[model samples]
Target: MVVVGHIFWLSDFGRFAVFGFYILSGYLMTYIMHTSYGYSSLGRKKFATNRFLRLYPAFWAAILCSIVITLFWGSSSNGFILPTNLAAIIGNTTMIFPHWMPSQIEPRLSPATWALTVELFFYVAIALGISKTLKRTYIWISLSVVFIVLSYVMNLYWHARYFSIPAGSLPFSLGALIFFLSKQKSVRYIPEAILASPIKLFFTSFCIAIVTSIAISQSLSFWLMEIIFYFCMAINFLLVLSLAKQNTFVNGLSTKLDKKIGDFSYPFYLLHYQAAAIASVISLGKVASLKENFSLISCMLTFLILFIMSLCVIKLIDKPVEKLRQTIKAK
Candidate 1:
C-alpha cells in the first residue's frame, strides 16, 4: 500500500489503488455483516454501537493529537486547526462535516479525514437499512453498478465535491453481491475445468486492462477510467474467490496474509497518512527524493519510524478507548 502511495506521487495509476481500497472495504464490510451475522441480525442500534466503538475512539485520539500539533507547530500552508464553531466541531466529531459543509474550510487534523467522511456516510447508509433491503443477489449487484455510475457522475459534475466516493465502492458492492450469491442454494456451479479456465481468463484480462489503461492514458476521462477500474477490481475479487473455493496454494498464501494484514490493516491505513505527513514535514521531503542505496535506506527508515509511531498510538490511545466503548456497549 505504501508502494502504491509512492507510485501515486509518480503517476496516475497509483490513484486507482485508492478506489480499490474503498471497494474492498465495502465488500468486506458487507460480507462480514451478511455471512457472519445475517443482515437481519445487524439492526441500527447494534450496528451503530459496534461501528462507533470500532472507529471513534482512535479517530478522536488522532484528532486530539493533530490539534496539539497544530497549536504548537501552527498551521502549515496545507494544515488547518479544527474550526472553532460548534457546528463545525460537532460535525467533524461525528464525521458528518463533509456532508454538511463545503470543502473550503480545511479539516482540523488529518486532511485525509475527508475519505473518512465518505466511509462514515457508507456506514450510516448501511445502518439505516440500505444493505438489509437487498433480498436478491441481482439487486445488490445492480445497485453496485448504479452507485458506481452515480459516483462517477458526481465526480464529473463536481456538484457534490465534498462527498468524494472512492473507486472501490463498486467492487465493495460486488463483494456484497458475492456474499448474497453464495447463500443461494440453487445457483449451481459450472464444471471444474470451465470454472478454472474462466477464472484464469478473467484474471489475465483484468491485469491486461489495468496495465493497458495505465500505459495509454495519463489523464483518461474520469468515468472511463473508473469503468476500467471497476472491471479490474471485480475480476480480481472473483479470481480470489475461485482460488479460495478450490483450496489452491495461492488461496492458502492469501488467506494467511489476509488474516494478519486485515487485523492491522485499518489502523495501519488510518495512521499511515498522518505518520507520512509528519515524516515529510520533518525530513522536508528529503527522504522522498533520495536515489540509489540511500533512497532505499531512507525509505525503509521513514516507513519503520512511521509504523512504530502509529502502532504506539494504536496501542496506547486506540486500544483503551476501544475497551471503554466495549464496556459502555455491554452496559
Candidate 2:
C-alpha cells in the first residue's frame, strides 16, 4: 500500500478505500445504534467508553514505540535532533497537537495520526447527538454531500488545514442511510438486489472508465477529482455490499477475513507509516531514493515487518484494553 502511494502519484485509490470504510461505518453504526440497540441505550458516556476502547490504547502504544525509535535509531538532516520541548512531546503523545494546533513535530512521528484526528472529531460529533438528529436517509445523504462540499470550500478558500475529511466517514453516513431505508418495510429490496446482481459488472466497468479518465485528465481540480472519486467509491461499495449479500461463497470468505482484520485495520494503518519512516532511517536513505531499485523491495519488507508488529500491538495492547473496557461496562 505504501509502495503504491509512492509509485502512482495519481492513484488515490487508497483514498477511495477510505470512502468505502466511511459508508460501512455509517451502515454498521446505524444498525447497531438504532436497530440492534435502542438510541436510549447509547448515551454520551457509553459512546465515549466505546470510542476510547476502540482507539486510544493501541494508538498510545504506537506513539510511544515510534517516539522511542525516533529518539534512538532515527536519522537526521544533520545528526540526531533530540526532541527537546516537553510541550511537543506531550502534544504528540496526546494526539492533540496536530488537530488543534499545527506543529513541526507532526512529520517526525506517526504522520498518519492525522486521520485519527478526523475520526476523533467524528466520534465527538456522533456522541453529542448530532448524528442522532439526522433521522432520515435523505437527510444523512444530503448532510454527507454538504460536508464534502464544505470541506472542499474550506480547502479552496479558507486554507483550512483539515479540509479533506477521510473517506471512511462518508461510508458511515451512507451506511446510516442504508439502515434507514432497510427499516421502511414498504421499501422494496429490489434496488439492493439489482446492486448485488451480475449487472454490477457493467457498472463496475463504467466506474473504472470514469476513474481512468479522471486520472488522465489534468484539467480537473483536486476537489473535483475528489468528488468524482467519492461517487465512484459509493457505487463500488454498493456493488460490493450487494454481491456480498447474494454470493454465499464470497460472503463466507469475506466474513472470515473481516473478522480477523476489521478491528485491527485502524492500528495497521496508523502504525505502518511509522514503520516506513524507521525503515527509511535504517536503510540509510536507500528506502526513499527513487533512483534505487531496491527501495521498492525495502518498502515491501517494511510493510511486512509493520504488519507483524501491528498484529503484536493488537494482541498486547488493544485486546487487553478491550477486555478491561468490557469488564468495566459489565460492572
lDDT by residue for model 1 (242-290), tens: 4334425333367667555555655565555455445554656422222
Model 2: per-residue Cα lDDT over 1-331, one tens digit each: 3233433233343455545555566666555554333455444566567767777778777767766665666543311234468876775666655533232344435655655555566655555444564455566567666765776666654223223443345565566666555444433545645554534543573556446555745565755665566566657556545543443424346776766776667777767656655566566653343223346666676677678878888788887888877765554
- Could you estimate the TM-score for every candidate? 0.70, 0.73
Which candidate's TM-score is highest?
A: 2
Every model: Cα RMSD to truth:
5.3, 5.0
At residue 303, give the lDDT of candidate 2: 74
Q: What local distance difference test score does each model get?
A: 0.54, 0.56
lDDT of 2: 0.56
Prediction 1 global C-alpha lDDT = 0.54
